[model samples]
Target chain A: MAATTKGDAGRSDMPEAMGAGIRIVAWNVLSLAIALVIWQLASRAVGSPFFPAPMQIVDAFIQLATRGDTTGHSLWEHSWASIERVLVGFGLGVIFAVPLGLLMGLYPKLYAGTRAVIEPFRFIPPIAWIPLAIIFFSGLTRFAFLIFLGAFFPIFTSTLVGVARVEPIHRKVGIVHGASKLWILRHVVIPTVMPDIMAGMRVGLGTAWLTIVAAELAGGISTGLGRMMINYAELIMVPHVIVGMLLIGLIGFLMNEVLLLIERRLFRWRWQVSL
Target chain B: MHAPISLAKVDVDASHRYGPLTVHDGLKFSVAANEFICICGPSGCGKTTLLDMLAGILVPSSGHVHIDGTPANPKKHSISFVFQEPSTFPWLTVSENVATGLNIKGAPSDQVRSKVASIIDIVGLKGFEDYYPHQISGGMKQRVAIARAFATEADLILMDEPFVSLDQPTREHMQREVLDIWRHMKRTVIFVTHNLEEAVYLADRVLILSAKPARIVAELPIPLQHPRDPLSTEFTEIRSKCVQWLHASH
Candidate 1:
């Protein structure tokens, strides 16, 4: 009886559930269509070449897909460049940050001792390190370094908070079962903090993507959507620049959606929705 | 397996203090192997604190707890627990949660699979083994906790008011199931509860404690056969006796 209530808790009434979903989809489409129409009219009225209308941006998007960018690199190539950097940086950040965060969380004295060193770097924006990155590193290393800086803090902090917030009973359960320290760390601590770690990784991916784009925009990278945008802007091809911006926004949204999907699948036991 | 394992003889002579406030004042007790003991006390009487001492989660300020003539070390003796809260690991499915203790003890995969399968069956959670904790009702989650504790095959199992959160009917139902499991497993259990009927129904003997800075006020043996009826004259007689002793302590 209780199980049925819990299963029904978040669901709409049977008759209304399907209707509600359709209504939501219709409303979203209508809202976006209305906004685009308004923007197109406003841009035409202004008649500034730099402010391309929505249709012009769409035309440029198709052109980029078929004709390639100013440097002859296709749209897919630019996107993959930025995406590969984000994944590499984000992956490396997670590998190092999560274990470090877990260790710091488990031992308070270690966290306290390292706070002075870690806290300062976290406050510094990734963009501010561009000059240093360019000077000390070359090629992919330079981009990876900046993107790593952007992604590392969120993942580390989230894991630390996750560890700290772990239920005392969870640890006691492990201890009572005669779990060794390593055993408890693996079975109890890691599993208990998984949701938080996933949350951190999601946020870190966003920041890493942002940092990679910024680094590409700052130049030295011949590829990526950001570099493609700069190349078009230099030639004053406003429509192509708008296309690059739109593509970045679309990809970021898609990336976040992918992570959200994974989160939903992995943590089906959690009560609240991430959104 | 129905016979006692002959290991879990617990001797506790301990006192605990949280700064200036004393929680257990020279509290001393002993539990025999396979004996089902219930520690009943008033609110804020530190029944959980006593269990923590027994579990080795908290060390007594001034005395020792020995299991089978050895010092109470969780690493040395297989001690399992069932907490009042919903403690099934949320990330693990029902079967995985039950297998936790055995997995930690490095039991072979085949042994873990069979033991977990049978324990889940005993607890009436056979079909729900693939489900997560949030998918189950609170009573069902408690059953999982019980199954996990039993599957561990611990020398001693500590239950701190493990059914206090359930509805009355569910609580009574769990009490009967717990008795059934105890009969088959023969693991020494020290259950702590404030409910008089619960203490009377489940325990071979009940230890009643006084108010703050608690001490054992009385120790009453149930002496009744298995499947004791709650409405029977003998059951109420002992319950009233416990109430009198509890009131007198205050």
Candidate 2:
């Protein structure tokens, strides 16, 4: 029976398993629909100026995409602005954080000595730095600094943890193989900790988006999704507000999916294990 | 291809003054080329420590491990080692793991690939080349480890109970596979194990060591042919002698 099963699996004529793919997409769409239904019902029952029905929000989204009123900017324009800020800030954060994190991880004494200082700084929220950032930098740069601060700690901490957690046996294996210290770091240490780094990057991406929105709402930036959302809220254009929120959710989801796809492809070896 | 590896007047003395305990004291041995030597004893015999010294993973306090009449160096890829555990890199596929040493030496990509393919085939892991270490069974992972050691093209391969984790059948199968690979490759192997039958079956000569602060107690030659039958009279006689020697020591 096992041999026959293997034979069938090997046959190119047989169709690949499409069931798992269908199930995942169906589940996601169904959950989203359920959430929208609950949201719509709540909006109608409350009858509040704050909450708008799903259809009303959809109408607002359409207007923002086409008409571009109140904020006086199109949805695409705001999205591009937000995305650009995130990319710049995230790129800088990764550049600075990874090397520092690796150094800290490799040297225990350094990590120990700085723990007292790092702990308190890590707890300081990115939004709390908005006032200081504004005073420090002029316009978009201030917002970028906020995003960088938001993303930096998580990536740094996760990288440190990943490097520290590299199995001793793997290091021993490299040494036994006559790998130089640099070779060990480049091949064994880096690849071993990649899954953790990818996870950290995912978390950092979310934090970057959150900080971008918050920084824009702090009213320094002239153009951003958060600025548009706030402007629409003040004008009582409920649809544009909902549109902005939906756009944030959609973009965040897409970015996360992209990261996840990269993770899956790069670490296919990891996924082969059942556990 | 090269002169036999010889250890002359080798004395390893490692001691710590921790109130009243002396860990290691004055140990000596020499191994020849193409020698399938098995170092067997009860647990805590420092068999692993001896193997580590041979592989140059650890340095002896007062002696040297010479490979082809030269002192062994950890920085030199003169020796390959396989631990009892699955030491194949979890992040690399079977083929990639096997070719890692060659890649580290900056060998050409095509040569490394071809060597890896051949070794994989030799170890009966041809179809599982693309599988990661974790995807495979324990026995298969050990095979990958063996294949990796063979692919390194080192003159000496040191193994510490390479099949200790497998079931009896799988262990026997792996033992045979290892012998076959060794015969074809003609590399010197120093296998450390406690299993008497395994030692007699695989080794050209068995070096039995005493319990603690291990010293070589006896050296027995197994004049059995290749693909040794464990149920054969000669195999049983050697096995009983080893069992008797170990039990008699206690």
Candidate 3:
């Protein structure tokens, strides 16, 4: 009888927990639905080729995803191409940015001295460099450069901010405990700055996506989703364009979710309060 | 009592545009091995400055803070400190925080684990070892701080108003815990605080100081036993004497 009562209580608690999660998901879906409704109404009222209705967009999306060679390529092929460019460019940016950011963070004097040079370049839009990138690099490299430029600044700046704001008390504690400079940086400073770095990476990922689209349009990269999107626009095929847009949003959301999951797992100590 | 640490004719001075501020002017004192010495003074009277000097976090302009006949060096890690706020790393679990000193020293993993577990248990946080600083109550956080200090195995521990943030009841409870730990470990402690009752409750001797450009005004040795009743006559007498000395100096 006691075991049955305990099991009932456990079952009851599970629903409460699940209810909170469901509420969050429901709220997000409601907002998306409201946005779709607004889009549909606006499109119907205007009745222009540019603004398609939500159902029409959905129908287009299904056609593009299912039909091969909708815009001289399938949706899968286009998505694969876009993912390839973004992954390559973003990977290169991270390789360069992380170490540079760490150096800038660790050595404030060096960072301060170089700020005059780095800050102006950071403000220049990645798309603004399209002409110069074309002049410098050929083919895929030009698009990659634009993507790299787009992703670099946010990650670097966030890393610098994170490293700079490491609590003084934590450093003092490390000193009192006889930690060497390297040990303190690795054990205390790095861990404290990780969440900020992760936030920067998220922002960088968004920037990379935006820049890739512009790069693909400007440079005429033959295989990417961006090229596919432009080609669909040129052909007045609204469905293919909608499909590409949806895929971009979905992929970005999935990437962020993956990072969040990793963050939660690796830094469980940070989120112990919620548990 | 055998003098384990001593300062003689110690002079610390700082000069600004507004003349000079003297922190310790010919300050002379001796602390016996395993003694609980609480230094009490008004705010800005350099009680913390004095503790910092002793801990070797600061260099006195003109004097030396000697530990076991050598100048105190913070880099040596001979003196462990518990600050006004619990200084446990927010990113680390209680056990990891406690084991940090050992980790820095590059002790073997098994030794660090066993020592941390024992210290956590000693601090009455057996089950909460896996908990992070934010997950624990303030009192529990302070307990973890205390456990970390104890676990460091440093012969001399310095504390700067460690219980100043706690409620009165919790503070009193922490005072007892500190005394109990001191009794069992027999480690020399130098505690600095602004609270008269706390100074009386914890110290073998209380050193009262004057206001800024501070100097030691009076040193009162409490002839009380462990687990002292605050209501007792001796406790009241010493407490009043320390308060009076503080007022007179100001």
lDDT of each: 0.88, 0.79, 0.78
Model 2, runs deviating above 4 Å? A1-17, A41-50, A272-275, B1-22, B248-250
How high is each candidate's TM-score?
0.91, 0.90, 0.87
Better of 1 and 2 by TM-score: 1
TM-score, ranked from best to worst? 1, 2, 3
lDDT of 1 by residue, A1-275 (tens): 12433334323244565677799999999999999999899999999987889999888989999999878999999999998888888888999999999999999799999899989999999999999999899777888888889999999999999998888889888888778889889888897788889899888988998898889999987999999999998999999988888888888889889888888777766775476
Residue-level lDDT tens digits of model 3 in B134-198: 77789889888888887867778889899988988888878888888777777789899989988
- Please give me the DockQ of candidate 1 compared with the native complex: 0.52
The CAPRI classification for model 2 reads as: acceptable
Q: DockQ values for all predictions? A: 0.52, 0.46, 0.33
What order do you get sorting by lDDT, best first? Answer: 1, 2, 3
The candidate 3 chain A region of ten consecutive residues with least summed lDDT is A1-10
Per-residue alpha-carbon lDDT of model 1 for B48-85, expressed as tens digits?
89888888878899988888887777888889899988
